[model samples]
Target: MKTHKEYLDLMLDGLENTKDKTPNSFSYDVLSAAGILFVEFARRFEELARKFDVDNLEGFELEKRVFQITGLKRKQATYARGLIKITGTVGTVIDEGKIFQTELGEEFRTLERAVIGDKGEIDVKVEALRIGPFGDVDKNTIKISKDYIKGIESVTNPADFTNGYGQESDDDLRERYYSYLQDPPKAGNPAHYRLWAEEVDGVGYAKVYRTWKGPSTVKVVIIDIERKGASSDLVEKVRKHIMEEAPIHWENLTVVSAKEKPIDVAGKIEVRNGYSKSEVIENIKEKITAYLAEVAFKKSYVSFAKVAHAILESEGLVDFDDLRINGTYDNIDLADEEVAVLGQVKLD
Candidate 1:
């Protein structure tokens, strides 16, 4: 029979080194930590029940023992229900009407610029602070990347503080996949969605959901995690993970890693490639265009691969806000499947 702490320790200890990889790239990133916790917990439970010859016990007795080992409430499953929510919206630079006067008399103005970023881009930082504000309501837990966001000293909106920052909407990408799943890609189905998932943490968290949004490729992920017990270091770990993975998010987006904070996050890495490396550049651009064309997304990376692909496919001519597509690391290479995926990129 193992103690709850022992189980947690065993689970977290088994995780491989995921340090150098992008956010959640390794199996034990934050999103996947829940699964790791579940397996060890169940094993310890069975062991304890059999050791005490309490297998026959049912109802409250069994329940009590289980809780004794896991510290998880019965409703914990449901409690985790919206553990994360990426909206189809984005945070805008907010002016908090603040000014800092240095001892030398230089006035530095400030605003409520929200910390915004997504997976892999989590470590990206701006000349902005990522700390969120306390919501109007109490008990609201909002997590933000520790970058490019400011004005934590004063705030009125709980969302910027409680809800978190980054592209809004997890289902925005799922909606696109559901579209194709609901309606099979028939002939001339100009825009189609491809998807994949893994059984992590006992739930099918979406690792990759690509779609044809407006004019850029957008990606959302539940970063894999390997967590043990609840420790104050947990927050710092999350912050470090985000900062380390920012560069892989985009080609040219500037991701400056900062101090450890809440959920690690970086800026909407703006990737800009030219016709010189157009082959590789165009590869990224095409997938991004297809993805952006289909989803009503939110972002300002209009200067991203979407517009770039449009220029290449059009013989070096690009139109402002031209219809485009999207892609990711998985299918970036030229492959048989890429035919269907790449075809999505066209003059729109």
Candidate 2:
């Protein structure tokens, strides 16, 4: 870990004890050049050493290598799929591969061919071209088509896309790695089921219940990366994966999406002078949503105090009066198979 100057000084001191100690001497210049290379090598060695340590490892490939020793691979992102309504003249044929896009340029392709019905509209299933939350567009935002189609006058999504999930983050991957190391899954235990469920793409967290139905029955409840209920497709994927990995003797495995327990907030609040009430309320909602995500599947109950604190820490809040979470001041208890989701936020 010696610096270039320190290495050079050490070499110079050795030279002084033998021959010349003067600056700009032949040995001094040579040692200075060597010191620069030596320092570079030292820096590289430090970095190389860090790569061996799990806490300091960098880059996706390197982390993947470390985790792969135990058969854990980084989960890839998942595409969002939803229904898009197409409107045009009756009998207009919409090709199976027709493309539609949102204002943000996220593209979706029709999964099936459909013709406009007698009502001049038909709902066709579509899948996002790319993976991740970018495809999770709001309802009515997908109006643009990649290419104009005859009789394809308009298109819109009636509901928001909610199943989109991004690639697993480094932190989340690392946490999974550590969990595997700390609690080694073996012989189809609950931890094994939970780990297997989370390994599938789009699964954020999973809770495993043993003997829920009978002696040999196991149930897994999962939430998506957005901390919302897992879509039917995602649930099927997890179910398939667990079935493939589960022991042959283990029968009756159920993979289901976690039930969403909406948390509604309503209160009276005072906003700072420069900030509008609406802005402050929006910020509070964001903070509360983040808190809910943090506690999802981790805490058995939503802390009432934490919700109030999130509102109190809003960017433009001056003071607050009465605050209620689902019209109750007490912590909201969640069932084991439930995930807390943010609902309505009303503030005066």
Candidate 3:
């Protein structure tokens, strides 16, 4: 906690107090520059201390070395999905890579060219080349981008696009690296399956259930990196990735998304002096969120003890009372294939 100014003052004081020496403004000027330089050096040294771990590493070092060693890298922009309905002649052909645009000018292309069927349904889906949430078109938002199509009926999203995200965060990479260490490399193991499932671009976390249905049946339940339920597209991507990377002989692998079960938290808290109620509440919520994220697939119960610890350890919170999260003194027990998501935070 000592500042460079304090260090400089000590040196200056020692020189001035010596009977044989005189320390004046002239000496102060020279010491001040050195003090500031030392301060910067100390600041950089502190930063260097944090760069050793994957959790605190940043920039090229993290992306190039740390993440690369873990066999993971930052995720880039992803395509969005749109359902299209075509009403044309029975033999009409919709070429692959046909570009379509939303009413708002967001463009997407068909994955494969297809001929019009009796029902006039185009089974293959389209994807937006541009990544992120910008490609997430609302239902009925897309109509026609090019003039190649015959008759346009409707275009919409069957389900919400949850995987369209920006570049991966340091926290995400850190978690993946830790997971890689925890799971390690093993063949035909549940942890291995889970690890492989999470390797897909948008996958957040994956849980492996051995013998989910019967003998030789495995189910990999996955969630997106944003902690939301995975989309069908992402599920297929995981399925394919797992099939190619780690295949189990004589075992049936099923890739599915985790079901989100929201556990709304309502509580009251008391903060220490100089802390506002809103700030303390937000801090508590963040702690709870982090705790939930870490223990998401590992445990089914949301421990009230851990919740209390998060609140008590939160900055500016001295004490708390009537802290009833989900109205229970007991932990919230979740069913299989269910992940807890934060819903409401009510505090007094």
Candidate 4:
């Protein structure tokens, strides 16, 4: 681990006892150049050592290779799917592959062809043209048709979109990799079922209940990447993956979305001098949401102290009084099949 300067100094000191102990000499410049090469070699050696350790590996491709030896792959991103209502003249043909978009230009395509009915409107299924959470739009947000149709008047989504998720992060993938090594899945055990459920894309966490109904019956409840309850489609995806991987006798396995436990926060707050009350409240909500996501499925109850800490961690907050979670200064217990989600932040 010797630095370039240190290596050069060593060479210079060794020459001090010899005949070539002079500054700006041929031998001195040669040794200095060699010192630089030595430093680079040392750096490369250190990086190589780190790559051999699973914990220190960097880059998506390198991490994938390390985990692939054990049959684990990074979960890919998922596309968002939803329904859009198209209104136009009756008998207007909406062909398959028609594109609709949001104000932000996120595109979605019709999955099937349909004609406007007698009511001059029809609901058609659509999938996001691209993967990731950007595809999940709010109700009535999709108003643009990429290609104008002759009789098309308007388009809108009646409900909020769901089930969109980004590709897994390196930290999250590493955690799962560690979980696989620490509690190796084996022989239809609870750990086995938990890992199986989590392997599906968009599933953030899974809780396994062994023998929930009777012997040989298991139930798995899962949440999505945002720490909210999994959509029914995501639940079915997990169910299908587990069934395909489980042994033939594992027909009693069940997969369901976790019930959402909304955590409503109401309090009085003193905002910092340069910050607006609305800004402070929004910051508090962000911190609280991150806290809830960090503890989902990992803790049995939401800590009252942790909730208060989240508020204190807000960037624009000066002080607070009478902070309440779910209208009480106490920890809220979560059921085994429940995941905590941010509800309302009512601040004065």
Best by lDDT: 4
- For model 2, the superposed segments whose C-alpha errors exceed 4 Å read 12-19, 58-63, 85-91, 100-107, 116-123, 137-160, 248-251
A best-first ranking of the candidates according to their TM-score comes to 4, 2, 3, 1
Name the 10 consecutive residues with the lowest summed lDDT in model 4: 57-66
Error of 3 at 82 (Å): 4.4
| Cα lDDT tens digits for candidate 1, 200-243 | 12111222233324333333332211111111222333324433
Steric clashes per prediction: 49, 0, 1, 0
Of candidates 4 and 1, the better by TM-score? 4
TM-score of 4: 0.89
lDDT of 3: 0.74
Instruction: State the TM-score for model 1.
Output: 0.17
Model 3's TM-score against the true structure: 0.62
Instruction: Give Cα distance to truth, residue 18, candidate 1, Å.
Output: 88
- What lDDT tens digits, residue by residue, belong to model 2 across residues 19-103? 8656687888889999999999999999888777677765576566656667887778888889999999999998898899998
Colliding pairs, model 3: 96-113
Candidate 2 accuracy as TM-score: 0.84
Stretches > 4 Å off in candidate 3: 1-46, 88-99, 103-106, 110-125, 137-139, 144-167, 211-217, 262-295, 298-332, 340-348
Comparison by lDDT, 2 against 3, better one? 2
**Candidate 3, 224-322: lDDT as tens digits:** 776667888889888888888776653588888888877677766777889899998888778888888777777878888988888788888878878
Clashing pairs in 4: none
- TM-score to true structure, per model: 0.17, 0.84, 0.62, 0.89
